[model samples]
Target: PKEDRERRGVTDGLLRLSVGIEDCDDLIADLRQAIERSARR
Candidate 1:
């Protein structure tokens, strides 16, 4: 994953999750999907 574009609170090896009070299920699903996508290649 790439570093966040907005760098105010970002660190060198940070993995930021921009969840604005969204549903926990959705957030977890999205993370799982992303992890699978990243692991595929």
Candidate 2:
């Protein structure tokens, strides 16, 4: 299962989030913060 997941290009840092009823500005801010945090590592 792990190998299959890896083969599909899903790495350890992958994040699967739910965007349920969130506003655009809020989502954008969240995404920017997430990307920034990932870039730091």
The model with the greatest TM-score is 1
What is the lDDT for 32 in model 2? 98
What would the per-residue lDDT of candidate 2 be over residues 1-41, giving only the tens digit for each residue? 88998999888879788898989999999999988998999
Q: What clash pairs does model 2 have?
A: none
Report the lDDT tens digits of candidate 1 across residue range 1-41: 33453355566666866778889999899999999999999
TM-score of each: 0.60, 0.57
* lDDT values, one for every candidate: 0.78, 0.91
| Residue 32's lDDT in candidate 1 | 96
- Residue 10's lDDT within candidate 2 is 89
Error of 1 at 9 (Å): 9.9
Candidate 1 versus truth, CA RMSD in Å, comes to 5.7
**Model 2 poorest 10 in a row by lDDT:** 11-20
